[model samples]
Target: MSPTTLTDSSRVLCPETQSPQTARPKVTTVMVKTPRVAAISLDYVLYIESAKNGPLSRRQGLSPIKWEKIVPSPRPAPMEADIVSFTWPRFQTEAILHLANQRKALQAFLFKNLVEGNLLWLAYIKDHCDYGLAVQIHGATDFLNFSNAVYNAFPARVAVKITMDNLTHLAYEEAMRAHFQHHRQIAKAIKSIRVHASVTSLTSLTVVHPDHPQQVMEVLTKDLPEWAEAIVANHPKVTTRMPPQTTNFVWVDGRKRPTTHPLDAPPSKHNTGPEFTTPRNRTAATEPCSSPSDVDDIEVIQISSGTAATSNHTKPMAPASPELESHHMETYIHVAHIHKGDKLTWARLLNHGIVHWLFFRSSSKVELIGLGFPIGIA
Candidate 1:
């Protein structure tokens, strides 16, 4: 009739039923923490050589070294031609492709899959490309979109030099100013402008029209920060150019508006998406419903949500096959270290779109140098 007592080693026995009961130790669950990936920027310098043009070479080199020195002869091709003649479409294509591949590789390294929110900016000190057609075509916009999807994502900005040659016609200068002014009417804009004049022209022109010199000078110098600030006081979106150093000006511009969080209550509602949040612990363990695969393979982990919080603890339910894993990871061979001597070859490559290919291949290297960002991360 005694009640049963259970101890560490003793089993329980029921008096009437003659049944034994055992106790099991409590199981402790532990959650391993995954480190969050840090954001980074990548920078690069594409030192392309000038193309061969017998006449232009003589003009740029043989002409008076000083901007002020008088040259009775007609000026040769503009300085712009001398600096970026080698960066042709073909070369750009090659560079772009190289960057694209590098981007893919880097995405895999960090997330174990390709997630397109990487930010990348292109910097060219004296490049004269009409526009970044190469970058746009490859995936620059896509990169921007991905960054915008995440609040912490940094927007990429392209920096380059705008020279006298970039102004195709003397008449276009007025139009460029008007166009810039239009942007100013909408928002505060920062622009870098550079003015170049032969020393003789600077001195003689200033003297000839001292009162209105800054006006003509303003036409050439409008994009400078000092000038931009003056304009911005009136027009929030003023475009000012930075002063020229060595007749060369490198400036940064916000090609797109700076990104803002919804919580911040920005003036513009251009960003299109739900407010972003740090991906914490919201991931689903099942395969993404949108994915094509249902095999539950190691290579294909289902991402229930795009939030980073969900991604932290999420793991592929199954391990990937050896071949599948190997294919996902690739190695980039450093084909060459572009140097001053290789300028001629680079020039030729630029003309052929091979430069673009090279750019793609060396994207990681260039990003490291140009923007201080890892190529893969961007």
Candidate 2:
């Protein structure tokens, strides 16, 4: 399923790294995998200087290993300070605390006063006559994170449950509004991998939901697009233009809406404008027309002295249209229905203001209706 450099190198190193003879390794600890096959084991050896060398003193050849099993030592008491019941004159916690004067001193204190394990075998290195190395064993950490070095050596196998949404067909811009979509099958698999403890070298992890594709393609098979871009850059410059982006705000009542008013006649109690202001909606429309308005233009009729007008002054209103009056309930719609024969009308919407949307009647295949309002209002 996955490859590791350590495993690759171990093919050669494992054959050469045989245990030395004099160091007849007595198994102190054995960590087994499924079916109880030993995956890792630790051994210890103690030795004393002697008058003469033993038969195992020569480091040249591999004789049969003298294997022996010893009774497991008593499990050590928990390392927390236990001054609640004193064994000597001074508090045990206070005496223990004094040993933590330095890092090495603290380790020495733990090795001397705390350790109590089986000493099954003994050997002395010929070169170094007196001193011998003492080895220890550790296992996987418990729920808490206070494990020694050996315990943390293996990737902490932990399962973390997580959630994913839209496990299938996602519409355009769906994630912005979509919420948690639980896939029971996928969740069952994700619970097997611990975030920081799982094997880091594995190239991929399979998500085993029925909806998930058999294999996800994160890497492309070829780099043709990058090669194409590099070739194109060496030629003459080709000007590229991107059309303006069009966004539509459809009326709740479909295409038929109250002109210059909220779509579907929303109540005034809790109503507010759209979250983002369009260019047309944020500014006033064009100034009043000097002549009778054409079908292609909207005229602002001086209906009344809008809040600032003097009482005595009243400006003449522009001639109204029967069609426009019915739609907005006020003045005419700026720019009447565009002629179907016009060339540029099909290319773009109304040019008098910012064009945020273009209305299409695909069923009927009729002339496109262009709403030329600052904010799609009447």
Candidate 3:
């Protein structure tokens, strides 16, 4: 038999005539590749476990938060005048106007922010008081106006207050003393001193003697030739026995002398110290007191430019030590960077292990890259 004639046609038979044979569709498999780009957002969280260990794990996180915006509002206008709501009577309008005018000029001078302005304002106010202007205004108001005027005239006075406390006080006292001396010299230099007709306007020079009565008497008698002998007498000392509780001294021209008021005078001599004595309330054998010699250095600083008034005495500051200078030196740092996705992943490789195979259809195949520092290291 021939090979062509031996073929079996039974294998190519129809399904209906065959013994229940089944057929399935053909299937194919393929592989695909694509380029991926990555970028670092420049935001990072540092977990420093140890300096040597560095970052153990890093995972991508959310972006940083931004600052809120600010909106500004316009300022309100100043009130010019209120007729019905007046603080002072309209009759004193002239004086008010004068004061207002003076205030404007003073304000301009104060705006200069100079020490001299503060001194000038202080001196002017002190002179105003010396000339018996105290009765025109309340004492508290006078002090406030004097203080405010000087501060306004020279804002830089604040700096002086901060830098040199001692020098400033000394300067203030010296200025006041000089002012007193100048008035006396001017009176003598002119030879004829015009006395104001009104007793209220008279210049009353008061000399206070806390310690040496003899010295105070001599200063009044010798230095003030303008004053009479009666005007140079010592202030009468008051004892606990005396009837009057308080003493008053009257200043006539350049002299200040104590006068007695029969009704207000005490009876007789009494001890200088307090009367009552108890274990808890008893006085110390030696009272706490400061001697003039104890002071090391005196510095006069000008706090206000518009007035000559000064602050009470203050202690001097000590020099800065070497340890303080060393402590002032501190260290800091600033960092900046720009990174691409691939570079970011490469930088994060040590913290996050290498990526395995990836699939486009499934999200499980995706991996996250992290970048961070070790905790407590930086």
Candidate 4:
């Protein structure tokens, strides 16, 4: 059979038994290249200060920033009183140089602490007397140059003098060996080494020896160090002193103190257990001494096994002498309550207790014949 033919505007079709043609859509892929970005680093210093205005301002204004360099504060200088003793040079040349350095150190200290630097003094202990070098300093540079020069040092010879009022005939000879060292030129720098014990640079306070009424030394009390002042104020025999009022009245944790004094109020007790006590009392006792000959001293003894074992032989030990077998018996009874902050009082009590216990335990005259209990305070 022949196929029939059909005509259309878009395509011509033949009536043949076959599948119909379909169009496939075309696809085009696009490549997008991204630009590379580089990292940027900026170094800058920033200083901030408290702002004077509010958080935001309506008007635009230019404000200039100011920078000020920071300076560290100077530490306090060591006081002359704190220097109890130092090794003095024996040669005249070395001694003169030593005094010059001392004067410089004193001046530096005064300048650091904002103290008036008018006078310079270098004091030392020699011949069991207080002697010093006092110089009136009008200018720091001129004074330094005058003392440091080795040739014709201290042109103004009248300003320099040596004190020898307390020096004995023997002491004067010894001091000459130490200070002058057989040097005529250096001796001329010192106006005189006459008998003069007073220090004229500052007002001197006399410190008398407790045992010797004749032995006395003078010190500059106005320039005493903190530690020396503390020792003097807290001495056991001092009676006219009171507890520091400034510390007692200061606010605690930035809060106002109540109307009642803290010591006057009843303290609340905290019970930690039976190991501690509430009362504050202490007692000590010692056993009565017995004649050394009446007590028998045993050094050692062997322990025997059961009767099943064979009998063993042992050597008998001789009785020890009373001096060799000496022992002391003492009992300490302490029951007290303490707080952690009471360190000073606790230290004093502990020192007394240890001394008492040591006296009996270490004594060589006692006889060994008593039971011992531990010495302690609860």
Give candidate 4's TM-score: 0.13
Which lDDT value does model 2 have at 100? 33
Sort the candidates on lDDT, descending order. 1, 4, 3, 2
1-378: candidate 1 lDDT, tens digit per residue: 256656645663656776576898899987542232322222222111124223222345544431221111332221111112123333233333333344553223223211332222333211323332323223544443322322132122223211112223434687788878867743443322222332121212111122333222212222234444545556443333323232323222212222222223342322212233334454433455646553343243332343222233334244332222221001111223344454554454344332122233222333222322233422
lDDT comparison, 1 vs 4, better candidate: 1
Instruction: Count steric clashes of candidate 2.
Output: 9
The segments of candidate 3 whose C-alpha lies over 4 angstroms from its true place after superposition are: 7-23, 31-35, 40-43, 47-378
Off by over 4 Å in 4: 1-47, 51-355, 361-369, 373-378
lDDT of 4 by residue, 1-378 (tens): 224543455353654855788998889887542232211111111111213222222223446322211111232222221111122222222323333344564323323322332223232212211122333323444334323331222121222322222224455678787655435433332212112222322333333333443443333324323213333345453211211223221112212222222123233321111121222342222224755643443122222321132122334234332322221111121212334465664464353333222232232221111111112322
The TM-score, computed over Cα atoms with residue i paired to residue i, of candidate 1 is 0.13
For residues 1-378, write the lDDT of model 2, one tens digit per residue: 356545654566566678655866687966442221111211222221121223313333545223221211332222222222233223223333433333453334334433342222121222221212322212112111212211332222211111112223243245444322323322332332222112211232111112332321111113222322332343243111111112211112213323322222224311221122225534333444534444345423342313221232345344332222223211111233444564464343343321221222110121122222222222
* lDDT scores in order: 0.31, 0.27, 0.27, 0.29
Q: How does residue 72 of candidate 4 score in lDDT?
A: 14
User: Once model 4 is optimally superposed onto the true structure by TM-score, how far is the C-alpha of residue 232 displaced, in angstroms?
Assistant: 18
Among these predicted structures, which one has the highest TM-score?
2
Q: In lDDT terms, which candidate is top?
A: 1
Question: Candidate 3: minimum summed lDDT over ten consecutive residues — where?
Answer: 327-336
Off by over 4 Å in 2: 1-98, 101-348, 352-378
What's the TM for model 2? 0.13
